[model samples]
Target chain A: MTEKPLLLLSNDDGFDSKGLKELIETLRPMADLIVVAPSGPRSGSSGAITSQVPLRCSLVSEEPGVTVYKCSGTPVDCVKLALNSFVPRMPDMVIGGINHGDNSSVNVHYSGTMGVVIEGCLKGIPSVGFSLCNHAPDADFSATLPYVRRIVANVLAEGLPVGVCLNVNFPDVPDLKGVKVCRQTDGVWASEFAERKHPHGDVYYWMTGVYVNNEPDAPDTDHWALDHGYVAITPTQIDMTAYGQLKRINDWNWNL
Target chain B: MTEKPLLLLSNDDGFDSKGLKELIETLRPMADLIVVAPSGPRSGSSGAITSQVPLRCSLVSEEPGVTVYKCSGTPVDCVKLALNSFVPRMPDMVIGGINHGDNSSVNVHYSGTMGVVIEGCLKGIPSVGFSLCNHAPDADFSATLPYVRRIVANVLAEGLPVGVCLNVNFPDVPDLKGVKVCRQTDGVWASEFAERKHPHGDVYYWMTGVYVNNEPDAPDTDHWALDHGYVAITPTQIDMTAYGQLKRINDWNWNL
Candidate 1:
């Protein structure tokens, strides 16, 4: 355990993504880094699997303590294949995505980026998802790497609890004030499809959205952290128990 | 609102699945049921989109109060098309699956059935995913109907809080047992690929798993409830925050 922990890295933005390159560059110096990620963009592919068909993984790079593979599958697929046979052993930690865009608040549910991290946490492994609040393919990640490496080092040193991981998002800014330990903001993406006509005049809609964060004034929220130029770290877990609604839903389902 | 609601139903198990049929039959009496599941099995398709090309949704059936559309896309796609234009107005309740499998515990992360529910929750619509712990194509859903209907009724009577939905699971058993409103069990699917050689001698790994609930004896868990023939209602939310570890992670991310 004292050895440089074998850290598995992945992302939704695919293997050649700038985010992955940045992540690999940052973490490669710290520990044994095993990078396995989708070869093509798998954004919004929330934990999907190509179950009916066979999937493939192409070896991309390797060094003494660094190895990378690009998978023709979802982000979770990369994690699974790595866990199954790609890695020399079970990874000490799994870090997904210095993501090309933010996966804060409700975005985590649809994020292929966070899906791999959640996959790792499901097995009780420490995991973290790093995201920058910039969507461009060549988004500004310089401001994000220092925080990503720092969080990874800390998690590696002080292991996360079973089923727990961190969803870290940074504001796309030059002068980050500090970091904020915040909760997921209460927000929802109202996806409005951009309707268009094809050559044959058939109508189709491209899915697009404006994220609507209803509760913005909440002091310690991921949205607030990003707004204030602080790295937002929301320690997330796979605990889906709606503690608030358990007894409230008793009237119908339980009475049966 | 007082009208018998427009119910959009789907499942990952294909349109012709027994679970889908049962669910449609169950909902027909209560609501204007619009069934828009995938054309073929989409068991592992989480939140994928057909952005590379245009997709199709063909009308399969049109009855008095029930209509079905077989879509060539993921569960989220079906919901998107419906929410965008296929339906007159947004569905009142979006129910994904009286699924032929359990989506309790960590399976939530891998479920296309639950993916639709989460999308519905994001859109501020009440959603529920009812799953039976049965994976057979001809699994009997008779045992699960009452609880399913009850939960649906309760949700309609009192809508879920925005961004939350009910993930209901039933044990594949005979006769009656009570329901348990519980927390997500600390469990994972220990998956191993069934490596098979094709006629062309290419080896492919088919995903298969064994459910390993580490907290088997924990009474308040979904796993325990399902094991005891009690229908387990896990009120799942999209926010994955483990609030206790936030400050620690924040400080760690900032220190570097």
Candidate 2:
């Protein structure tokens, strides 16, 4: 009989988040688990690596088949530390989050959860990022377990293509309408910062934004699926190349 | 007489880098400029947005058609602050970097330079990120001026497509072979952390890596263009969706 697959887990909401705990409870028995996650919440850390300062990691817990470590870095840093140094061997799969907030639409580019998944994909490993639409610290992930298990199993059974990973976002509903493979909705964050005056008379700004979905009615988009109460599974790639514009750019006479 | 174009500028290497200085020197006389950049070096920050902490900005310099503010945030945050609060109006163009190092191939995904550009594109604005292959604190950018001027002129004359921007990397060589619009090359950083022991016995790791280009001979790739002494201009997009894998994923029987 084959041994259980080794799985690496990480999240952006820190190692102590309810989402990470839920993921561990759901997947721990199914796979040999090694978790290396940020010591604190690192939301909006998109594929950031900590190069300015040295990173420190401490082993917090260890079991027969599960080991967890907290690292002083971003989500991508956790994945890098695991893959490059901590893991005994390259894991069969890398899973990030069951994140506290949705990583759909333009959030995919700003998500630390997706950052971990992207790092995994770059290393030629099958990777998946799971996020819930709810942003509360106490958000319940009970509704997402079955879908998560099924998707994780499917990914393990069918490894992803090169340079691609799955970004699965579950709606914050008690009853799910099932899973839909969808495309990223065209969207942008109408970002604004709220300014406040400090006691010292200095002004500080808190980053805030509202996501505006441009294709709200598009059935094939992840945004639509979530709005319709379904789990949205979007296959994401690391290549940012605009293949459609390449020909036109080539036609530009740079020589002149 | 046409009004002078309003330009927004930023960089990952702090407000004091020579690259940023050169950019100001090159573009200042031609356009109205609003510069919002990190107050300190923020390399490897990628597209990170500072959300947990309140950001502070101090006006460093203000002159007719040229104003500069230093922000305590990531590169993306600088652009966000500029667009959302600092700038009186959305600028005609956003320019990032003249970075201290190359942001070619897979580096684009982890670049603070490209982070600013990506943010601009998401906001439906024309954007460009310029990088030099040299990583010195005082790298000679003289060789890059002609190419930079030409590319910036073209971008100003002809705005980029919707949801698209430019990732332009210059070879460090003094001699030039002109420019090539190419695709991002397939590459991964073989990262390793150098472990060290503190004087008090705590362990820390410094992040380091070597980029390995898998397709070194592909003439169509940005890496090849850079290697052959050409300034590589890759038209980058904000979309991370893997359209090629969509149909196959949709066919997956998730119902089971």
Candidate 3:
């Protein structure tokens, strides 16, 4: 008999959120699972690590094919802790999210969900992050199950390339319109702060923004795919090097 | 005069750190500067933003050529706030760091210093992040001054390509060799946790690890440049798409 493939799981919305619960339910039967997730919400944490303080992790539950731990750190911290101390062996896959909100386009750079997958990818693991377009804690995730299962199965069958991971987003509609392999849309968040006066007569700001798509007509972009009701799968990479600009920068007159 | 070329600056090491002070002193004569940085240290805060709570920003001082503000948020948040409400006019360039520590190789993925420049690049501005290999609170930054002046002047004169920013690292030496345009070295942090037993008998962990360079002999990488006492300048981009693997993933049997 063959041992089941081990899957390591985490999320930005904490371990008890509906998104992670649904993910655990969906993948538990297919693999021996170990989940190390933040004890509280850590949205928009990007790749933050808690080096200022020691981390506390406790086993939340352990059943036949699954074990879960809650960590007092960011999503990336959970991944590091799990790989360094928690997992019984190297996981076959490192999966993040079923995040409560979409992580498409420029949002990828600011996502704690993506942080988990990026950390895993950096450690040479095949990784993927999943997100729903809806931000509500009780948002329906039934529409994402089949696609998630299929994607997981395919990745398990054919491992991802080195330094590459997947960022998958599902539209909010209950019924899906298939999947589209897409690129990150060129976009920026505009009008990102709402000003308010504090009770002490000081001005404060809250972050709230509308995304401005630079290429709204591009059908190959993740934003367009989500808008068209398709599940978007963007293959994200860890190498941030701008190879195209390297030569241009090399020609600069460095008078030092 | 071309309005002295407005420059916006920020750093991850808090607004009052020696690194940021030196940066301000170096560039004060070259440009009209606005500095908005974190109120306290936010190391390893990679692109993280504050959405959970309202942010408070207070102006610290305003001189003839420089103005400084302290913000209760991450490095990325400071950039957003400055761009949206603080800057008197659109900045000619955005600069981050003169960081107390190096943000080379995989460190860029977790450096809040890099987060500042990445935010600027996404907003379609010429941006650059500068770092010194030394992490000391009072590290000697004299060696980096000339390079900073030249690089900033270069970027100001010739704007960066859309979606590209620079991550420049200076070695800790007093006398530096000439600058080297390099790629991010392939690397990962290994043995990342130091476990400890709590007084209450619970196991906890602290983050501390050694970076394992996957390609140490590669002379064209930032790691190599730093090791040889050269200023390494790496062009970084906001686009995370694995363009090389998109076709490969498209060929996958994503039968959903």
Best by the TM-score measure: 3
Predictions' DockQ, in order = 0.62, 0.78, 0.85
Error of 3 at B93 (Å): 1.0
Clashes of each: 0, 0, 0
What range of 10 consecutive residues in model 1 chain B has the weakest lDDT sum?
B247-256
Candidate 2 chain A, poorest ten consecutive residues by summed lDDT: A247-256
Kindly report which residue stretches of model 3 are placed more than 4 angstroms away from their true locations once superposed: none
Tens-digit per-residue lDDT, A1-256, candidate 2? 9789999999999999999999999998789999999999999999888988999999989999899999999999999999888999889999999899999999988899999999999989999999999999999999999888888888888789999999999999999999888899899888568899999999999998888999888999999999999999999998889988888877775753
Off by over 4 Å in 1: A251-256, B47-52, B197-203, B251-253
- Expressed as tens digits, the lDDT of each residue in A103-157 for candidate 1 is 8988888788888888898877899999888889988788777777778878877
What TM-score, to 2 decimals, does candidate 2 have? 0.98
lDDT, candidate 2, B148-209, per-residue tens: 77788788887889999999999999997988899999999995688889999998999988
Local lDDT at B78 for model 1 = 81
TM-score for the first chain in candidate 2 comes to 0.98
Worst 10 residues of 2 chain B by lDDT: B247-256
Say what the interface RMSD of candidate 3 is.
Answer: 0.9
lDDT of each: 0.83, 0.92, 0.95
Error of 2 at B50 (Å): 1.0
